[model samples]
Target: MASPAPTSAHTGRHLPHPVLVISVVVAYLVALHPGTLPRDAMTTTVVTTGVTALGAVIGMLLARWVSRRHGQPDGQTRRVVLGIGVLVAAGGAGLAVWWQNLIRAAVGAVPVGPDWWAGATLAPVAVVAATVVVPRVTAVIAAAAVALTAGLLTPASAGADEGQPLPRTVSESGTLLRGELSAPEFERPATRLVKTWRGADGLSARAVIVAVPTGSGWVDPAAVTGFVDRFGADVRILALPYADVPSWQAFISDDAAATESSIALVREVAEVLQGRPAGDRPLLVLYGQSLGAVGADAARTWLEDRHPGLLAETVLTAPPAETVAAESDSPRVVVANRTDPVIRWSLSSLWRPATTPDGTVLGGPRVPQVPWLPVISFLQTSVDLLAALDGPTGVGHRYGVEQAHWVTGLPR
Candidate 1:
């Protein structure tokens, strides 16, 4: 056999594989601390960097293996390498999806970027494009990854921040007071509003409006303000303070305790009102969201069972219909999201009763009371109403005296 043509200048002089560089960069990004980016940015960066790097590594290995036979002067080797490159890219993309899902379960599912699978699928194509145009594709992708991850630190271009939480309260004039609830009322941040805007004209004259927030944990007090501005009519929203609980997780998980505690708060507030000058005739509208919604329903049921003529109306947004009794003739409107998995999970507990018709009236075991309507939307309509522009303004839980969707349709 003719001496095998001395392995040409190409012998062992293989160009550094692009895949190796890409993989290293990806590992670096994934391994980096997540807190460096804002909540949304963190998800996007981690997913992209992880997927791209993995794809590159896989592509390089495949290319090396396929080069043996296709390395002919005629050029079959280039074709083989190209085919292998595609396969490697696909594999890398698949891995990215898997990794992202794992991360999601670990942290609560906040909005990351596009779904992991979709991102991974596109990784190979991006790599190919980078390879053709850029001398160091790996470095370029890495740089892009860093930029994307870091960019979240910059406020969004929309001039509004969806990721950053809203302030707990705002004035009708539009001032944002951003911060967590105080130590005492952490469970129910809405309580702070009572102290913050007590002097806003007509507050003392208006009927005492009780806002029973869901859970012992805190939600943005601003949401409460939005609700008050939208629906409160000549009424003051008195937010309950957070009760001392071991932890947020415990408060949310311990439904019975939450309900009992909330009921006590409502009763205490009611008693205080009862001692006032016009307390007996005061129009008490019990309102709440999610868990607080249930609390409002239960409190109404208690009043119907005990006081009879105490409350005027109860409006619950995303209320757990099952936990609530049907003794309300006070117009009740419920907002639900078709896409919120949370509603389904929470409302189905054995402690809660089956849902009755919206207009059903209840008394003892004989009759049911009140009207029930399910307002459906993709987004949590009630939450959106509060968080979105048509909501409240200013800061420190001050519910503007304006009207919005949730309040506009009420039977004023």
Candidate 2:
């Protein structure tokens, strides 16, 4: 039987196992490839190095097994395998790099330099560069990575199953969910509620949505269309203030002004239906996402306290660290994704794992197997929050129709 060699050499008595060397190198490049979101340099480095080393160890074991059963190829077979591997590796590495750039382009990411095309040549060179590290070195590195992973998951796994409190937030997303909608005020100063949809007859609706925008504070036109298109008919009302505050900031800063504006918007909605009896009034739903979602919950609580049974539905997406307390049997949705670091992050998440979404509104874990480790999960998830909006639609903070879809499905 023949022993394995490094990717850089076919010299000495043992030749490199083409499969083993190729597998590890391929894995490193693939891991570097962007996911639903882009990663920063530090995260890219951590991810690539960990995956590369782990793949190397697995490749070594598999190669050894193949050698024991079938023996290593020699002469022409050996040379051919090595040649083919080099070609394949070069192609695969280049492809993965190019694919990531395409994603960057889609998101309008600023290039490292204006001479971006110059980086194209580096892909093929990576095939050679990737495998220069000795297998033993990679094996050691893999051990360290495993230890790190375990340490972080320890905190995440604690109290993961024990839960009594109701929900909260996805995939990694580097792209921002951008929207272009005008925010013109109504008759009231600083307060506005635009009618996004009306029945075909142009006179009726079953309910009205006091919808707030995502953290960016700009309502998405598609979302307005969604409520009407999905449900066949409903008057879609978007809540806004004349001078909008960026919604994402609500996470770090206590924007009492914005929260109060949201409260005022709900009150205006109630006034519009003042003369009608409670049973005859169109169902009022307070809806929001991220910080907006948090505000919606708070506003609902305030409204319910003053006028019971006014808010029949409340939908929140990607709410931050805490949930508001309410005293009502109103139906609501706390859309959450297992992979969403935003929902997974909090002081409580240091020991308690994220709760799963209850019903169909984008429920279930996007990355269910990743266990939560105490401080580690918190830190890792915190990093994930950087590019949270970059994920695809309905992922991370880029929710679309699903937010309303879940509400429409519920018994109204």
lDDT of each candidate versus the true structure: 0.42, 0.52
Query: Ten residues in a row with the worst lDDT in model 1?
Result: 361-370
- Model 2 lDDT per residue over 203-294, tens place: 24676676655434545444556666655655545455322334444444554544565676777666656657766666777777656666
Per-residue lDDT of candidate 1, residues 113-197 (tens digit): 5643344345534653465346376667667866875654331111122333334443232222222334333334433343343
The 10 consecutive residues of candidate 2 with the worst lDDT sum are 166-175
Using all chains and alpha carbons, the TM-scores for the candidates as numbered come to: 0.40, 0.52
lDDT of 1: 0.42
Model 2, total clashes: 17
Candidate 1: list runs displaced more than 4 Å: 1-204, 216-223, 226-234, 243-252, 272-280, 320-329, 346-411
